[model samples]
Target: MTLPSALLLAAVVATLWIAARSWTLPAFPGRTDFVLMQLSAAWWSTAVAIESIVPDPADKLLWAEMAWLGIVCTPSLWAFFLWSYTRGELPERWRLALVTIGLATWAVALTNDAHHLFYTAVRPVNAEPGAALVYSHGLLFYVVTIYIYAFMVMSIVVTASGIHRATPAYRTHYLGFLVVMAVPWAANAGYVFGNLTLFDLDPTAFSFLMMDGIFYWLITRRRLFDLLPVARDALLDAVPDPVLVLDGDGTVVEANPAAQALAGDHAAIGRRLADLPGLSALSTMVAAKPATVSGPLTLDCGGSPRCFEVTWVPLTAGGGGREVGCLLMLRDVTHRHRAEMRLEDTVRRLDLARLEAEERLVAEQEAKRALNGFLSMAAHEFKTPLAIIDGAAQLLLMDAEVKAPGMLPRLEKIRRAVRRQINILETCLADDRLSDPAFALRRDRLELPVLLRAAASAQGDAAPGRRIELELDGCPARMTGDGPMLELCVHNLLNNALKYSPAGTPVRLHAWSERGPDGQSHLAQSHLALSVADQGIGIPDSERERVFDRFFRASNTGTAAGSGVGLNMVRRIAALHGGTVTVDSRLGGGSVFTLRIPLCEEAPCEDRMAGMPAD
Candidate 1:
């Protein structure tokens, strides 16, 4: 039996168990990459374990190549994990460069047939079971080994460098990390240079089991910095934004340099909130204890006054979760405030009320036109990148069919993603434009039956294969709304149902008038309800609330082309009518979008806009 192979498998299992436990930790400080490291090591161990006992030379060679995927990444991931753990961040460029070199190294190892730069030769026959694959290391293999050790040494040096400045609690954690990150590489180096082997197998993979054990102890017993506060020097102090924390009694327990400078009290700690005259307006909100943003609190900083908006939230602790303190973040809004003041002064200097009103109206109209044009132009600009990607994919498609057949479907997926983006671009822009106040609602009396029937018929015509059933017999004949906007809403809703649901499915369009709760129209304002129900892929329960939010698509709507803004546009239109829109949906069962609008009741007036003077 291959005892080394069994131990290697045990290493794989133990590492994966730790990886599972690590998932519950917070995201940053290399927590994500830490789990990735474990998973990568687990696979490497599994491959090496299998390679030890496999009888066929071809099979052994395949597993050896597979192991290189994890091997090439050993140093880079270690360096990144240590840096992120100690410093809380690694620059994106460094991460990209490391990953690129690692993957390129793996690729060279993978296709060693063409160049043989990674391994000069590989075979199964020169050794017994439970032994390393028979292979002659090439120049590139040693080069990559040096590359790995470079990162190993660099990580140890960088982590230890910060030890003096780190708090006493974190300095020990730093030392522990340097040990945990370097052990496997140390074993790998020993195996290559000093012939350290377990039952004729490389000891590198087996060392991970010991590394995982130490990593677990560091996290649970020694209190690794994953859950600790931001590193005082790199983050809390270096940030330009002012931050302050107070105890329950309003004593300033902590204040960053920016916060102290903003308050003009270098020694703000231990001072009560009431004593800080700069925070008088903020002090009043403490009794209320609401987590909210308030006030442009003006601070007289040595004659140069600065205005700040306070965003505060209650910080609670202990068993009963009693309010322990509050954290305050101050954002300087002096420039915006000064701009407003300047605009007000300019307005006051203007001639007369009538001229001001005329000028304001003209300015608003011009701004609206310019804004709409800009949004459209910006949306189109996004297509330039997408088009470039699509063209590249198209060129690769012909090449991929011959050289890399497996990549054909991936290229097709990219093409599909590009086309979907194009389809949704206009709707996204249109929904974005809806937020402008200049896109005013012009409500007019509308015949409900005529309007709804026209919409359903048009949608049905466009998608000729499906049935759009209209239930409008009980609906009241008249309502008030923006005619074009209402038509747009109906079209959007209908389009979503048809697009998401399977072809030839019947989509029910129901509209009816609801009498007052007392069964008298005069007692309360009468209302009308309209619904579109489709038996298509329904919205997931978690996402139902956000389905009408701009650019939110249901997770289940896969590969069905859709502009996520359709429902959001419907909601905006509904709001303009002084009504509400909501969805009732279930996964695989379909969705019902209900839009309820208040019906006009006073004297059943016709289109009032016809006789009313324009603003």
Candidate 2:
């Protein structure tokens, strides 16, 4: 083959090699288009090489016409290749338009003998050696050339656009892409518009083949396809948070879809940060140029207020890692912000309620002190008058013979009434002391039967005719407790029983040494049981629990002279001794009030129980 045809064949082989290598590469954006572009260049060179070798002018013209297949496809496919490879993807309509133009150009060029719109005439320049055919120009030829040049220009423009956006490492690769676009475009432009040729043949295929070397270097050495525009798109578009990449001047450089939604009606890209009112605070903070800072930021989104946690980090680049811009990420925290506000409101309300409760407690305590003082003073002052009345009633018994027989009983009744009043006053005083904070159970060794017998005797004197029964079958002769409190407890129980029951009815008092659970009298397992049983107005079932409350009385206790405090005071004394007071009775039946106090608080039950013998 002549050197010219040999060069054309070499270009074809190189382009085919590039296509074969690109075909084996892992698929990425525009990889198919790139491989097709190389194949088209190879086909174009093959057809041109045939035209260079053929002898007859008719044969050369036929080959030249056949070459239009690859010639028409090459430039348009190169433009498409660059669009998919760097611009991420070419729109379908543009791709279809490129394809239609290529197929229509091939059809028109093939039928030039009839329409002659592509070439008016075709003839061989030299068939001897290093020569090929030339075609006379037609209107469609320049039109097609212009459009092909337009495709290359678009590819160059689109590829160059990304050089600024790419990192320093990839920016070199983008420049390499621009070189790839310019090679065939410049060669073809020179041949068509400037009458340029390489060895009497078009130099477009030769330059295009040389471009394959640069593309190979970019793919293999520069790792071109690894960092595709598609990856950048997927990463930025997938983020749910508003991501804004700003220049050092706080002008918006790049904003994803989320940022667009957040900006609402405002056009984001190319706009200054101050242009967005919702992002003004973030813009100011970005102006300060902090390395990293995050806080609450509120934004108006579609007329509804939404809160976000705006985070700013300086986007640094290059070997020096100098700040290029700030990446503002606004994470939605509306739900969290509103919840915090509600929690703060609840805490404030709780604090106010606590203050009100404390104030009420203090006021109630003062009122209680005043009421107790009045009762104590009143009790003290009336005792003298009560004593005088009791003495006068007794003295009238001495003069019973001077009066009617009924007068003696009437005087006796007056004395009994006065005694009951004095007992009531004494109960009031005991209740007052029980309520005192300083009041403590004065535990001392005492006789259980002796205590009960004395309490029984005191009640008997006050009632005149009521029988006070005492049963100390298993009672310990010695016990440990406050003598006055225990005696007072018994007196209060007996007093309540006698006052509520019929005047002729008798009340029973029982005391025993009782064992706790499992019949073991060790540790807290044992207690002393004292119960007062009286056939009186019994408590209703519903009010049984409340009967021990201070100032609480049974429903059946109608017209019964009671301060409603004696039983409450008894319960208080029992509790102070680490025990409880319980009642068991049915309505209209007698009630049994039992007080159980632990006998082993300080020591073992065996020691406290051994102190007394059976009574």
Report lDDT per candidate.
0.74, 0.76
How many backbone collisions does model 2 have?
A: 1
User: Tens-digit lDDT track for model 1 on 4-41?
Assistant: 78888877888888888777644447776677778877
lDDT of 2 by residue, 1-615 (tens): 668889889878777887887776556777777787788778778877887788777777777777776787777788787767755766678767766777778888878888888788776675555346677889988887777777777778877876866544456778877867677777887888787888878888878778876777776764333222323555677799898877667777667779877777787766788888666667766766544545576787777889888777776644466565778888899999999999999999999999999999999989989999899999989899999999988888888847666688788788878988887888787778766766666758887787889889878978888998888898777767778877888989998888877777889888887887768535536779988999987889999988887788887788866767887888777766777789998888889999998775362222232222221
105 Cα displacement, candidate 1 (Å): 2.4
Each prediction's total of clashing residue pairs, residues at least 3 apart in sequence or on different chains, is: 0, 1
Residue 451, model 2: lDDT of: 82
Off by over 4 Å in 1: 91-97, 121-131, 222-226, 237-615
lDDT (0-100) at residue 316 of candidate 1? Answer: 55
Maximum-lDDT candidate: 2
